[model samples]
Target: MSESTGGTGEGTRAVRAGLPEPVKNEPTLPGPVFAAHFHLPGDVEGPYTYGRDENPTWTLLERAVSELEAPGRDDVQTL
Candidate 1:
């Protein structure tokens, strides 16, 4: 067990750092409002075939959290 945030070096990083800012998706401090889906051009297929598949906000949060957990997050599983 680490005297700091867990013995894992990755865990230490997670504890010290925060999330990454949204790059292309960035909004004002207000941030991008939630959109269930983006309209695709005719026959464009899709950026997201379905809303259930993925969302921008979800991705932002996931990326941020992923970094915090870093090496520790090798194989995250949700039961």
Candidate 2:
């Protein structure tokens, strides 16, 4: 356990910490999302524009890595 990883060991933090909470009948890890563009009816500006740029899956991974690097802290930006 390490302070940087919220008291979880490096392996556990690398594998599970900051990941989306598991639900019954759902996989522990989310699968990759495949799409070029989503239906944008109203606003043209948003976090997701194209798959090449960013998506929800990537967002989760980013947050997980950030937490592993600096657990229990919000001031640091990992992305």
Candidate 3:
């Protein structure tokens, strides 16, 4: 959400959004990406129900991508 989002280009957004964070209730810093499946109880409810729904895998992938690409101007040691 920005006042100038209307005219911003893809590259602008890519550089402006900064970077994403890792999500999980575990001690893992960066995890693996898996198309997981889930099962729920009839007397219970769950946020995710399918592999494509949402899982730790997607979160791990997102964080990995962000971290791998999150290099500041000075981070470029050479080239």
Candidate 4:
């Protein structure tokens, strides 16, 4: 595909995308965030206010899977 869309190869993009940037003395991959409930201390105006609704970890995984399924494309919907 194009370099702008997902850089070089499928294997490279699949493993690199949807992951946190490398940091000094930090794990390459981050741990999962699990929570059945969250403290709504203020106005609920963020992407994550409930666990059941969505999870950051899951979102990243979904993106990675989508890229693997269809590279250089945006018409992807996961159930």
lDDT of each: 0.51, 0.71, 0.46, 0.68
Query: lDDT tens string, model 1, 1-79?
Result: 3443445465555543334433685752335645554564675564544466576556545655665555445354221
Tens-place lDDT per residue, model 3, 1-79, is: 4433347665654554433443576543343443446454673465544477456655444544453365333232221
lDDT measured at residue 11 in model 4 versus the true structure, 0 to 100: 56
lDDT of 4 at 71: 65
Candidate 3 regions with alpha-carbon error over 4 angstroms:
1-38, 47-49, 71-79
For model 2, where is the 10-residue window of minimal lDDT? 1-10
Which stretches in model 2 have alpha-carbon errors above 4 Å?
Answer: 1-7, 37-47
Candidate closest to the true structure, highest lDDT: 2
Tens digits of per-residue lDDT, candidate 2, 21-69, equal: 7799999877777657666578778668666667887677778878778
| Highest TM-score scorer | 2
Candidate 4: the clashing residue pairs are none
Worst 10 residues of 4 by lDDT: 1-10
4 Cα displacement, candidate 3 (Å):
33
lDDT accuracy of residue 42 in candidate 1: 75
RMSD vs true structure, all candidates: 6.6, 3.7, 13.1, 4.6
Report lDDT (Cα) of residue 17, candidate 2: 59
Model 4, residue 27: C-alpha shift (Å) = 10
Give the Å shift of residue 35 in candidate 1: 2.4
- The residue pairs found clashing in candidate 1 are 2-7
Candidate 4, 1-79: lDDT as tens digits: 4354535665577677666568999988877676556565575576675566677877887777776677656678663
